[model samples]
Target: MRRLPPLNALKAFEAAARHQSFTAAAHELNVTQTAVSQLVKSLEERLGVALFERRGNQLSLSPRGMGYLPAVSDAFDRIAAATAILDETDARQITLGCGPTFAMRWLIPRLPDFQRAHPECEVRLSTTLAVRELQSQSPLPDGVDAAVRLYDPSKPEPGLMADPLFTADLFPVCAPGLAARLKTMADLARETLLEVRHAPGEWRDWLSAAGLGSMVPSSSLSFDFHAFALQAALDGAGVALARRPFVTDDLKAGRLIAPFALSLPKGGAWCLLYRPEAAGGSAFLKLRDWLIGAAMPPTA
Candidate 1:
């Protein structure tokens, strides 16, 4: 027979450890902060170990807690995944998580084609921060069926499976009006550089590739995401670095221009990521194949 702490206590402990705050975990679990605290205390007493360290206002995991979390989280995830397979209410609707810009500029537009191909399936998108992969210790969030993002194969994540969808090549893109001024790479010094806040080093990488290692833009503007940065460029605010999937339509429509032939490969592929369990589902497979097909370049 297996011995276990109270399921409610385990839930409280997991949520508190993840957020590092009783109040935040309470908000998520829809319980009082006092209740969460008591449950965690009970769990610690049951285990005969201190799961968390209370340092004034900051709460952190103890060494035992740090080591204990992954197994606990994975157990809950397995239960949730098993439960999800039994849920038929939304069987045809699959939730896909990705960055907002990729959803807006790339995925959403092509979704219509997928719908045309398989009208029975519904693709719902949940936008996440521009991260390369899910946090190492965290499971795929409860509601997310799958996710797609840039994945560096060099850093292999054990539980998740990744399938390459697109080779994201980065290059400078700006409105046609700004493009004319950027006739030569040296002329970049005359223009404002639009940058995404999370990827501050992109401009430096592109400049080094162009052999203008020390060059700086006349001025610079920063946005929280690539979508905003690209929008600023579209309004002639500045030149923003872009990947092919995000700019293909605009570049073809003459709304944007890639002034230089030099494009830097991201040293990674934008890949579809999911747990091993979801691989066999027909709905998941359809979406995966459609995404892969949509990302392919046109054939002559």
Candidate 2:
């Protein structure tokens, strides 16, 4: 039989030791700091060894703990990644990730077509809200195959492989009702513009490029998600200057309308992200091809 510490104790130790703070560890494990401390204590008692030395509200890994942590971490990460792969029996799972706006605006509308093309593939969509939530993404969870991501290509890699998918162009959009009320860029002062909090400086940069540098509207609607911003447009809340792919469905459906003929090409690009170490996955490849089909331009 395999000799092992209690699963909870091991998890507690990993989280606590990785962060060097029981509080930070508790946040990841979703347990009380005191509970995590107790679990670590229980583990040390069971093993008859001190894994960490407490030093005035902080922790330092003991000599033995320092030697043990790397191996234990690698083993757990491998077990988790493998279990995720083994859970898919029919090769039907693909864990997809994208910004809320991209998913709602670009991918979700086209998903049914994908289902028809490959009835064997089941895509599990995950809303990865740009870069802010990148770390929240775990190795494709048990059964999650792959993910699509939107990122700034100029930005450094965050470990995942980034593949060029498409260039997302930013433009001003509003409810059809609101669109009728606007006459010129100067009319923006009378309206509330929905801005993405995460993509700071984008609105200003676009406006400045248009030679309207001083046209900062006094009122605004801010949201962290593209989805929420789009929702605001649908509800006639305000105008949102968002990427084209993310608002394609709403624009096509006439729930929203483009007020400006000029579209600003953004610095960010859409990417197909996957673990470099993942073994060849036939199902994942097929899904990647299907997405590529939709992203490609007609002339290309």
Candidate 3:
């Protein structure tokens, strides 16, 4: 027989520890703050150790709590995974979480191939601007099975498995008419420079890579999302820095042209991330293999 605290107490403790706030944990668990506090206190008394240090309004994990968190979290994750396997409702469906930009410009375009290959497995995509949230959330929000993120592989997050998809290569791209005007690097000064608000450094990186760092544009336009910036560029608003994978179809269709030969490789690469246990599941493995195979270069 296994000795364990009440499941509610464990859950309350875990939620409080993760957020470091009883109020936030209550919000997450959909219970009263006082209830969360009582549950955590009950858990602490049962364990015979202080799990958190209360400093006035601030809450932080005690040394014992720090040591206990990973084990507790992993146990919960395992329970969730086991339950998922036993639950027949989700057996044929795989939930994928990804950035809105990637979903719109890259993943959605290639989804048909995946559907064709696995007609039995339904790929349910969820888009969010907060990619980190997808990885950090406990109980894996809305039963998300996996995530595709543009993140640095060298600096991986704990408790998640990451598989590299592709490195991003950025170059300036615009409509065909705009391309005709950009004969030289210095010619960028005559046009409006388009920028994605979230990735303003990409333009600077591309300029530095092309050795045109001194060139300044006459005007500039900024958009909150890459898709918006790319659309503005397609409308001849200005030249936008394009990630190759996102703009491949546009370039091939002659809707967007890369006038400069120079391209800058971004510091991060696109990758698939998921819990370690999920990696072994047949549905996830199929999707992972398909994604990696799709990223491979075609044979001559």
Q: Clashes in model 3: which pairs?
A: none
Tens-digit lDDT string for candidate 1 (83-160):
675566555778898889999888888888899999988788888534533344233565788888877766768878
In order, the Cα lDDT scores of the candidates are 0.87, 0.77, 0.84
**TM-scores of the models, in the order given:** 0.71, 0.63, 0.72
In model 3, which runs have C-alpha deviations exceeding 4 angstroms?
1-70, 86-88, 129-142
Give one digit per residue, the lDDT tens place, for model 2 in 1-300: 998999899999999899999999999999899999999999999989999999898799999889878978987997776566555664557677665667777788889999998888778777643553545544333333455565665774655566678777788889999999889877877888888777767778878777788986878978877778878988999988877677766787898899888788876777776765444455677788888888876573
* By TM-score: ranked, best first: 3, 1, 2
Looking at model 3, report the run of 10 residues with the lowest lDDT sum: 133-142
Q: Lowest lDDT 10-mer window, candidate 2?
A: 137-146
Residue 141 of model 3, lDDT score: 48
lDDT of 2 at 150: 56
Candidate closer to the true structure by TM-score (higher is better), 1 or 2: 1
Per-candidate total of colliding backbone pairs: 0, 1, 0
Model 3 CA lDDT for position 254? 96
